[model samples]
Target: MPSVVKWSHYALLAGFSAVLPVAAYAQTEVEAEAEPEAATTVTDERVVLEADIVYENSADNTIIAEGNVEALHQGRVLRADRLIYDRTTERARASGNVIITEADGSQQFAEEVDVGPDLTDGYAIGYSARLPGDATVAAKSAIRRSDGINALEHVVYTACPLCEEDTTPTWSIRARRAVLDEESQMISYRDAVIEIGGVPVFYLPYLSHPDPNSERRSGLLMPNAGLSSTLGAFYKQPYYWAVSDHSDITISPMVMQNVNPLLGVDFRKRFYSGAVKFETSFTHEADFDSDGETFGEETFRGHLYGNGLFAISPEWKWGFGVETQTDDLYDRRYDISGQGDKRGLYSNQPRRLLSQVFVTGQGDSYYTDAALLNFQGLRGEDDAARLPLVSPLAYADKYWDLGAYGFASVTASTAILTREVGADSHRASLGGDWNTMKILPGGFTFEPFAELRGDYYMLDEDVSGKDSVARAVGNTGAKLAYPMVRPGTNVDLMLEPAVMAAWGFSNVNDPAIPVEDSLLYEFDESSLFEANGFGNFDLYEGDGKVSAGLTARALWKNGTEVSTTVGRRWRSRADPAFDVASNLDGKSSDWLASASLKMGKKLELSSRVRLDEKDLSLSRFDMRAATSFDWFRAVGQYYKIDERISPAGTSDEGIFLRGEIQFTDRYSVVFGQLRDISRNVNTRQEIGIAYTDDCSRFELLYNRSELRDRTLGPTESFQVRFSLLSLGNFGSDSFE
Candidate 1:
């Protein structure tokens, strides 16, 4: 017999329900948050009561409700089979199937409940609470104080659910008494025991956890422990401090049996328009190799990384990134993997880290980016003095669509580069292009394009090129293509034949100019017809050339697709700017061939290769394949190049393989390998096993790396991680 007043569920339970997190993963917060203030707050809200059978004694100022009794206050609801209220004392008592539903959707059950003055002091017998994230807390009796404190007798807490046939939970904490402090917002347990598989394994006289409402409270985070050959047995613990509602910081200390302790700090904050984060770590120790052999004088070694971005206006923004290290081998030796992140900044490579400050702007048909970048090389032979500092590398582009006349685009760019031990240079350039395409009656397409560019440069006297130089260049070209299609009931096939011709004037590619950015170049079918295959402004093609290519695509009703392209370029006058290893140096460029196949989301294969014009032998090759099935999935990659053609001017070949297999719904295994085929060495290998379910996860992994840089040699490592849903994660790792 339930009849309730009109209400909003969220509004009613807003007060107490807001503290659900304090009760769910309540065991982890005790050390993090400060003691709550004793001050009390008052809300202007009233309680509503309803029941099927109601009786009142006016003389005694009392009311009684039987059968489906209900009381609602500020979204916290209490339901019982019988309830009695004393108006004079402002007290209430309820019995039989009592339930208390909190504002945040948590629920408590009891056989008897009693309320004290102003309905603020509530206590129950036979108490059990179901918190968010499927967590549960049970006790023989419990008391809820209006001052935000809770006390319980004979308590049991667990996040794992019990099996239908097995009454015991997978893990649980049992205590003789538990109290949640109103001031500290922490839970303290007396005579507590941790149980696994229904068997008690550990005991403590006293234990505590903190729980803060509406804000992240300070606390101890998950810790790491592991045994390693290099660092010996080690343990790393971190403490979190919630500086304010918008910012926080974490301090971690790593102690090892062999090496000196290391200290690290991480801070993060947010503002109205953006956010920023920084992490830094420091340690004092002599240099050591992978085998834990120490050398050199001991000193302070550390690293710092940071990133931030803010909006200047709706169309403009500014940001900065910082990634610096005191030494080259500190990260690999200490396992500090990620350097940092800076938005809008490009990373140089894995061997080097790049930091930059940048400003960017964007609008319809226009875009621009400018950055000041500094490079830090991680390799042993890298010299800081040789690294360049790029100041104000900027580019801007604007495009216009001219109906019937064609599309036109204008671009401007500038760069200033300086190095401690190398040549310094500055450059400015402006360019424009216009093009239009027309489709003829026979499904043949024709496109004509024109381009012009000019550049002014200033260089250091030490450079071979020139102290200053100026150059202007232009090219005009047209492309022709015809498509032939064959459409069938079950399949579709299309073939396109294309040809391009272009003439260039004003050759500006001078050896004296010093190659600044176009040191790395590769020609593929995608750029086979481009008048200037060089990716940067420092080089240009200034002669007549013709390119021809054929493209084929097939689609099947079964959802399979395949595409292929084959092309080559013939230059009337070979560009001297290209090196012999670049394949584009000769009048007739190497044949470029590429193909791709995708099969209904389950399989994919792609390959691109360059063939020598003399014998059609493979000059360069890159291939990749991936496949997925119900039980297993795998991906493979292969790359090869002549040493002379590579960016490092060294022949290289490599292969990488990774795969995962699911043997059961809850168990899986993962494996990976990266090998340098040319050097006949294994760079890395990984093997791991994992178990997962709705509420928990566990993993164990083995990793091996053979990279030998400086004093660091090959090593093998083992790591394990475990987590409970809604709670926290903890892990340990070690190397030998």
Candidate 2:
């Protein structure tokens, strides 16, 4: 049987307060940590008092309890060496090691306390309180009134832990007089002085903040200040408005020394089933170069980005995203980021952004998706007419379980692509596939699969040929693999040899149907044995081919692993649809090899390479490495491509590396670099030093960037940021 229980039931029993105080304290701690709604009124439950001696004087209507007195009511508890209650005045007082723990888990410790019969109002000497999240308040003395206000003298507040040897905390706030308003759950200090490293830094007449138990309250947030080569000295102050329980907005206005002021706004709202968020910024200024030199005509420049997702049903949902800008260099010049990081928003390249609306649904054995997509180019050389807009791109797939026999599945896809200056096209495709797997003797596996697909295309203009085009594609294949495992005391080894032979219709590539999604096809180890390597309806691998691969892996007992795979494909006839640089143009494809190594989680290295089959020369390679040392951690990636068969000036070689060197427990240095090896230029470089303590953090950063856009050319910046606990935080967009 299952039983339900609550700790309050146990708290109602006699003499149980001492045994359950710890449990009750834990419950309140969790509630405080979550910062739930504040309880305004005390519970009316009867107070259960336990003590060694209890006496009542009817004549004076006074009750006295001594010798380890304890009073419990719900989760709240009061403990002291002695307690006195005046029935006539409805007041209760305690002395000698008095401790009062509220229902919200806040604790107060004092030598003596006097209050009403209900203990709601009190006066205490040597008072100190511990709030949630390491925040504390101490005072020489305090007075509490029935109005739920506390007035304290000689108050000290801090969220940092104190060291016994040093005594001083990382940071502290000292005030001559402090007022705590329980009704508003706020603390206000008068004649306060801020101290850092035990040295007075700033003085304030008045300061107020929530009692660490409230969040999302409306107030002026922290300010961001920086100096940039483009914008010069800039400072932004942001104010947050808690419009309602379900919505909020932040308005940030930035003033710059070199240009006109800019305003940034962010709004968010939550619904029962979903949420929406948007951010935008606007500025009016003349065109400016990287040197902050103004030119051309003055104009309004800004950018708007937004995303939203909502649920329609249990198995269906829809979402939309949008990104737009008046010019190419606005975001970079203003240091804006966090765009294209939402659902339905896709950014394929560094300077290109995609806005989309999509609907998706899934069932036990079926899936479907439909989307409408648009593109925005942020590159200086981008031609808007050449961009593509795809509407009603849809796909659906369903499969059935065949148990003993071969399984079967059906898939359908359709797309409509339109461009301002290029041809408009529409394509629909339907395919059926059947496959099955069998385990044979000696740990051998064999599989057979067959697929037939038909695609119809309609073009508004000529596409190599004229008008509509239709093609029927079919492929049948059989794959065989033998995998073996050898377990040893020190290492475990595994090897697998796989081969596939597929016969399909040749010369099925129709020139009248243009390729959209399969323009950059590259055969690699991951697709070594696949019958069809192309991903779109227009281009399908329809020639007979044989592919083979060998994979080997070793795992050591000390959490080390190494793996390698090598594969190649042989085609009966050359496929003209693939370019030479793709490694799949000739009768024999390039040798595709990949290797990986992992020395536990702190280190990893992986590489993939393609070698020309004719000369056995390196064609292209991408390598990545990551490692963590005692004082440093770094990750690096490098890639190079052969220039012989690539587009003019497009063959590329580059490396990007970034990491942090932890020199101490509280300090570290971070750096990153992106170098264009072929061009002998550093595209981006950054270095920063960071420091953190229990109550504060400080950072200093420097960055340099060199880009192709004339308006966004070489620039450098240095930034500084610092934050303190309970005093809000301040930061800006990263240079990267």
Candidate 3:
């Protein structure tokens, strides 16, 4: 006769009796000692069964269970309305709503199943499985081989959710036959069809990919196709290679109908301490004229960019960056630097790409950096030969505690630059500053500071009558502040009056000391209290100055705050070393005013203005405001600068507005525009509509730009993007 058991037998009761030791009983029955039995008398380690109703049919050496039958074998559970087990053959058959749950928590459902001893090998009809990654597979018939191979026929697979209202998924794949290879974590599909919203969209003869549970694998990524006015029709196909656990690479080939194909490769590797990345692209294409016409010459155009950083110790690190291009217009002509109008008033159009290798160190009280830098000019007007290359630039700063109420700091920097324009120079400078503060009676505070700096330069082109020059400067200043604070139940207010007097003495100006680093000077509230307004060693304030300002701040209990500051500077005499365009060139500098307001977490506003003290006309003005609600957000920015203060000798005034409004839970519209107020034209504008859900997102966008360049002209285009959760993104051009 055979035995019957419940599913719990395999999990909790299979070896329960064996686990209890006989040695414990020997201690209490020493006088009745007996010889131990042979090991062959032990129990078999096969499946133990239990059920609500069980019967043994000795005629065939079989065990049959009916009415809530359950069985367990090798960490797997089987349940059915009726089950039969042949003990001699170690085989089982189940019928009527059969379910098998593996030790890994995966479940298989079938109306009928035939499984071997360990449940690893089985054949089932009406088979269905729920696997990891929220995936499900159903088939009319399934075969599970002992070698960990699963085969299914007429199968449907999907990861999307199923609701009672609609059984059709957002996306799914149907196949005539599929095989899952557990060892390689891959699934192969034959005669597969992809369906979206229950409608067939595409078909493939054969396809194979890593299972959804895989984190990394080599495969073809999503492809992109687009139409461009400059390039005609283009397509990009990208392939990703998972080189190793800590490294990967992607190679994308771009094909254009009218131009040569471009190949781009990106590589990345990570170590325990740092990471490195490199990207490069190349093409052999004909050059284009200013009017977007292809010319005679076929040129090799490419760009290489790379960066890496590693930690040498707890406080020291080293890194290098590479930025080189075959030609400046190559990127713009190919539409590679992302879509937008990059020539806006405050866009900081990157005319120069800098490459550098540096090592840096920082501690509690000191910091240091040393680097070698090279620059490549990308603009037609910039002469690459005139740009200086710094072989080595080293800087260090350290601070020392001067007991309870004072501190001292020293800074040193040196650089050697070379250029073809005969402006090569080498300079070294050191500076030391000390300050002490005291709190007087009546809520008054006073701080006095002093600084001494010395610089020595060697010039290759001595057009100013000297090949070498040395200069030293000394400054002393004192700051006084009086604060009044008033506290109320709902708000707190503070008002502070601050004043500073500073005196400077330095060597006479030497024009040969070329102004390289401090060419753009700005008089703003951030620099109002500095002893020397200049930020570099080449320029130093020649005389004395007095700076006065008033600051007010208010904070409310509702998490709202407001702050304002107004300041001005008065010099003893106008310094000729300072450029006339700099607001600090006169005895009385521009009036600086700044204010900010914040209302809770949703709104913020800030503005800064530089006014010509004589007529109160604005020399520079910048304002920004942002607000957000439950379903909407808005941001606005305005910037205006006088032509006299512009290094390029051009005035810039613009306003940028952006907003997003959500009409429903899953739909939203976003719009933005950049308008040149000075020219009364729109530089760029974009509008997009998007739909987003928990598992997918779709967006359609229209973009327009009016930026004109040598190789690139104004552009208008439309783009569409669709993203699926756990899948990749697909992008295409709708119009151009």
Candidate 4:
């Protein structure tokens, strides 16, 4: 049985404080320079004393002392109501209220104790001890090995010093045996009963763990078990493999009644140059209803990924990543959804995975790039989206400086599509310029630029057998802005009036390419000048398009910054080059407006909108705001896309809000909600809270949505969570 102490017993132990005034002592030096096989000799160079001593000579040639005897040796001091010393044998024995103390602020007590001649080995029957901080332990019998090492038989250990009175912890373990090897700094236990509030919660045949001061140990991690309405009862046993100081692997085998046994693995390896990480899962059984049909399409899916960085030279380097996975229901059914929804859309056909490989070199003012691949999984209406098993194409480009007067760049690239609508397209462009110059009575600045572009396309028989087409285009533009300062509140204000006029001409026949990729063509800077600038450039006769637009902007700052922009555009004959519908009878006006504001250092707001001048219909509206304080933070965003275009789907609007609060250092909570305005419904709501204490912690989580439900509530659900995350003295292994 473990040692049990009463209140009076603790008071009695506290009474040992009367011995604190004893002289301090250092350790006796013992020469220990030999091989591992030799008997170690340790020396204690310091010893002190104070006491009422009674000595007795025994037939064993030992000298013993009794009656409130106290002495200090090495870094430890001992006290007892009675003690017997053996001078001839270099050993001592003590009984009746014996207490031992160490220099590091730890104390041990026992009813009867025996000390070794060299202080290297001893035994204390019915001993209890408290280490640094609030950690404490007790046992029916205890033995000291080397240094501060100890072993307790029938022991109980706890980091909560305040819980000393209860031998059977409310939520702790009672071990049949325990060993503390101080020299190696480790602890182990056998035949342990994991109890909670004096009740047995679990029983382990054998277990071992590291002490509070250790960082790594070879042991079994805590097992996890849970029940899900869909997955039934499940359990996961995880094992950790320490490959080295910087690398490790965790393999977890899952067992559940609703599905086949599953094996999940996470491997991490660190090299002198970089690191590599990978995770994968595999299973052998199906857990879905197939309308009573025979097992079809034997379930099989796994994920493998490896990415790292390498130093090519002093000023240049390269890195790449490959994220690939299988199983359409991998996220919804297995709880793997985190990155995006594209991976969670399950289909009977084999799903496609995207993979890309590219390299680029960067310098002070110029950069070069090249890539030999396809952006897999990007499906077009006419072709499948699966990744090609082999490399698709190669391309490269370069950019440079045209002195401080202006800048220019050139690009050339080609690609061969492999799908049914496949075609080989090549593009080459060269552009350069001149900037606006301001004549300042004092000091001023000016900026402007112009460019010329060209393109060539070759068609495959499967696409159109249209042979080929070549076109060239030119554009010229300029902008001038002046800063007007307001010295009233030290606020600098800038108001700029700018205009751009461009003329483009292109010769091509039969609208060279399709319109699959030209959706975002309107209101863009790059399309300012280019052959086939807009898809289906041949839809119009020889491109002789003239367009012009004027923009006004103002920037002002006092304690914070603010900016605004307003612009309008008009073109001759609704230039197809401007992506303006050729059917627009006469000249039409298009307008854009935007504004942003920031106050002090805590709050900010911004908004932008576009409209068609003819009908005055809202094109796009976006707004965002955020604020933070000592205890709370909140952020909100709104996005509205017109019916004209929305990526992948028709236009829709939505709003999202997120906030968090800190009650204390040990407690915090967070909340987030997403609402779809167009559908007049809530997308989702999430909330979570955490609380920590000296011995353990509790976590609560809840989420609600119409699409899916993980809890019992139709629109609301939550879960209670707890684990051994404390017991500070046991380091952080309590959670492992």
Candidate 5:
């Protein structure tokens, strides 16, 4: 039979429900939350009973209910064989198979339960009481709270159900007085004893984890240990700080008994506009344990890196980055990599600080960028092979619609370079070219092009009239090609013949401007139609140089491709030619050609060669090849140079090899080797391996040589990262 209560009683129930926030209930169960501690506290509040239930009044403010016993107050429901409510103390004692259902649908059952009026205080004296998740925490007594804050005395909490069969649990934490703060969303335990199954594991004064829904509750992170042959045994205790919803920081304090104290911190902040990231590591330790007396006190080593990007507008953006090092030996000592020069030829190094602020934008068919690069790391003692100095470079190009034909374009740029010598050199240029084509009915195309260029230069110091040169060039050419190719095993074939005649005027005396910015060319098709293969616009050749070239490109079955371009240049009249100041010159090369061939996703070969018609010697040769199999891949590249230059002033030959292999899903290895054939010496050989698991990533490396003479020995590193992405690693599903 359904029992009815007065409308006033309904108002009281509505008041209680309105005071509390609904806890998250399983989809099938109602989600309810405990009210603020003020109105309903552990020591206050009273339980309201309803349903066709019979109650017997007793002494000590106790009300005993039986037969479909149901107590409802503050959105919490409890049922049992018998119920004892102590009004004086606001505690409810339920016996005979007790089941206390929370507003969140999570329930607690025991042989006996002593709960407060609002279900904020009291305990369940029973065999065991499990949490919402598979985490079953059993103790002699379990205290129940409205906020899901359960205190289990003498408890054994484990996620593993079959204790006997699975003796080794995934992991568990046993503690005294575990407090689950429903408001803050954290489970904190005092005097906690963490264990794996039945084994007595580690002990900590306190421990905490995220509550049911919130996994990224920032707090004390886990500790890790690693052993390195160089650094001995080291331990790290990490602290995580959740500053806000958009920002977080992690500070790791590492202690190496064999060495000194080390501090590493990483900060990440995401704003509504953009993001900013930074990392810094510091270490103080003796050079070597045994040689401590010789080196005296401890050494200070550290590295700092940070960068950020800002989107000013939909099409405009800005970005800046900085990397600095305190000591060169920091890498070898700390097992961090800083090898080679402080700055790789491509690396931007700052002495005090380096920054680049640029606003860039691009549109269909045209683009432009202007950037200010500040390089404080450029020391006057650095060699040309080292990093470049801070300077300003700007380039803008636009394509124009030729009245009745193909297209016309104009490009202009300038640069001022301050070398390590503190000398300033400037180069400026403006150029324009036009291309027009008339297509025949059969698809043969007649294309003619002409370009005019002028150059000027100024230097801080010069000798023998080598400061400036000016030249004018005019070229005309036609391209003939047919797109149709025989089909079968062969998929594509393209052949084109090109001829050009150029007459230029130059003073023939100018200091060479090296191709510093364009050293390595990987994969780019922009070089096909350029007036000069070089990237800069400051130099040009003159004096009636006629050139002829043929291009052939083919694609075979299974995605195989081959392309080749061969051309020869002949000058009607010539005087003593300029020297090989930079490699991109045709003073003595009678024939220059480049070719590339790729075979079915496995192999790729490319070569560029220049021949000295007079000496019958190879002036320059660059070759590269790469191949990949199922589990392994390798690539090799070689460059050679030959010129009538003194030993002190000479070109270089080098070879580089890169390889990688995947051992398994969890592990992989990589290797890189660079050898300088010019000096008959191996520059570097590095091997590295990375291992990934649920908890974190571990990296091991063995490099014979690095950045320079710095040697990174067998070093092992471990990083335990915790993020929203890592929540899956917990593997805690099926909440009970």
Candidate 6:
């Protein structure tokens, strides 16, 4: 038999339908949202209870619920095997498989729990919780205070994935006591131990971190340790400062056993329309001479780098870049820049650094820019006094549609260059070009183009002419091409043969006009049809020339592609001013050929070569190939330049090889080597082993470089990196 007894002042139960009156304790359902600290309080909200059996004791003012008991209050749900409600005290006690789910989908489970009337303040035994960010916490006991603070004892927390077959997590944190402050969104632990694969690896007396839901906060980031042959043992500890919602800064100080310490800082800020960032570092240390010997006195060494951009409107923008270092060997010795395997790091070395400020504007038909440029030379052979400083360089270009059959473009530029050893000059130039294409009979295409340009120069000193000179030049050319296509069952083939002839009239090359640009030249298939082979206006091709090329392409239905090109140029006469390496010094230039083949996504190969027409010998050759399989990937590159064909007047050859193999789902190996064939020496070599899983990653790398730059000599380094999910990374390196 079931009996319903209602208290005079409180309605503890509602919507009950088991052998009793169901309407006596009815009240309005609450309509309120859940909050992080606690659920919203609604005056009219009623506690709805359901169970297999219920008994009300009138004298004790208590209600007992048994067998799959459930209670809903203020959009929160509670479930247990048995529940007891005290009408006098306005409290609830649940035992046996107790579970509570909040409106935000967060869940808590325990064997037993005691809660106040609101369900926000509670105490539980054998407690576990699952929150956002894949975070889980389990503890022996948990207590929730009215101020929204959760205190737990003997707690273990982890974000790692757990498999039923293997209950051990990849990484976990064990703490004797932990406190979670909902108001501050932070978790603090005391006497904590970090374990990996059930083995304790690190311990801390006190530790605190932002909750997983926090985006940014002020704290100490992970530290780094390393060893260098030049700097000896090194360590860096960084602290992050969250100044405001729109700005932050990081300060890192590095300590070295053999050298002075270094301090680095990075600042970043966001604006309504754009963002800016700056990073800089400084050190006070004794400088090293060319013989790898340190000086008696200490000096300041530093680098400053920054960049920023903002939009005036949708089509107009402005930006500037800065890259300045105190000395040439500072970056190489300290490993300040080019820390990764980049092409520029290996091929170009740190020979130059550039700083520039510029503004740019773009419209539908025109573009313009103005800039000031400065360069710092970092090579032992370079003369810093002779380097030019370019100020107030301006350029603009506009395009116009010439009716339906042609288009015309106008370009203008001006520059002022100042140098210590060479003549200072201010120059301005304007040029216009027009082109039109027509399709004739027999499927042949014909195109005619004309260009005119004028230049005015003012010089502080003259070598071959007067102080000021004006010259005007023009060129007219025509191009003709015929295409043939053949469609087959499995492949489609296309062949196109093209010819271009142009007559140019320009002022003879003036020795007084320094070759500030266009100092390096290379003739390839892509430049075979250009009106001017020179990259800049300082050098003009001059006179009459004809170029012819043939292109062939084949495409298969299975996604294979092949393309080839062959081209050559014939000059009216050999020019004495052109160097022999340019290939343009002869009546008939060297043959330029290139080919590429791609077999879907598995393999790709490309090669380009320049051959001497007289002897049919290779003058220049470059080849690259890449292939990949399910478990392995390989890449190879080779380049060779004959002494007669190289601009440096020396034979240049090199080879680069890189490969990676994955032995298992969690382990991989990578290796690479760069060798200078002409010098018969290895420039750089690297090998690394890595392990990765859902929650953590680890890598060990060994690298060697045989570069010889003044005081900076060959070096070898070993590095170790460990990354744990949500906890940042730890890195260490040793160099010799």
lDDT of 2 at 202: 70
Query: Model 5, residue 685: displacement in angstroms?
Result: 6.5
Root-mean-square deviation of every model = 8.5, 7.7, 7.7, 8.9, 10.6, 7.9
TM-score against truth, every candidate = 0.85, 0.85, 0.84, 0.67, 0.61, 0.85
Worst 10 residues of 2 by lDDT: 1-10
Cα lDDT tens digits, model 6, 642-661, are: 99878878999999998878
**Could you tell which candidate, 3 or 4, scores higher by lDDT?**
3
Q: How do the residues 11-95 of candidate 1 rate in per-residue lDDT, one tens digit apiece?
A: 1123223222212112112212453321111113324556787766678866667898776766778788987666667666678
Model 1 TM-score relative to the real fold:
0.85
Whole-model lDDT values for every prediction: 0.76, 0.76, 0.74, 0.53, 0.55, 0.73
* 308-343: candidate 3 lDDT, tens digit per residue: 888999999888877777888777777665322221
TM-score of 2: 0.85
Model 2, residue 356: what's the lDDT? 85
> lDDT value for candidate 3?
0.74
Where model 6 places Cα greater than 4 Å from the true spot, the runs are 1-51, 54-65, 69-79, 83-94, 99-108, 113-120, 129-136, 288-293, 338-350, 462-466, 486-490, 581-583, 599-601, 625-629, 634-636, 732-736
List residue ranges in candidate 4 displaced over 4 A: 1-219, 287-295, 316-318, 337-352, 372-416, 420-444, 485-510, 514-608, 611-617, 625-631, 647-649, 660-670, 675-683, 687-697, 708-718, 722-736
What shift in Å separates residue 236 of candidate 1 from its native position after superposition? 1.6
Span of ten consecutive residues with least summed lDDT in model 1: 1-10
Between candidates 2 and 5, the one scoring higher on TM-score is: 2
For model 1, the local distance difference test gives 0.76
Candidate 5, residues 1-736: lDDT per residue as tens digits? 0000111111122222321221111110111143444333432345555435444355564455676666665777766677655556755555787665656554555687554455445555764543444344456665545655545566555544434555454445556666555567666667877554357657878776655345465776666665555566778877888888888899999877567778988899987767878778997765552211224566776877677777787776666665666654454466543332332113453333455555566666566666556554324354443444545666667888867977887776666666654445566667777888777787666666777665566655443234644445444444444444455554767777665554555443344544334434211123433434335443344455555677888887777888888776555454333334333344433466789988854988999876666765776788999888867788889998763422235777889998877799757676778887777666677667755433233345554442333233323233322211122222111101
Off by over 4 Å in 2: 1-88, 93-107, 130-135, 140-143, 150-154, 175-194, 200-211, 340-342, 345-347, 462-465, 557-559, 628-630, 645-648, 723-728, 732-736
Ordered list by lDDT, greatest first: 2, 1, 3, 6, 5, 4
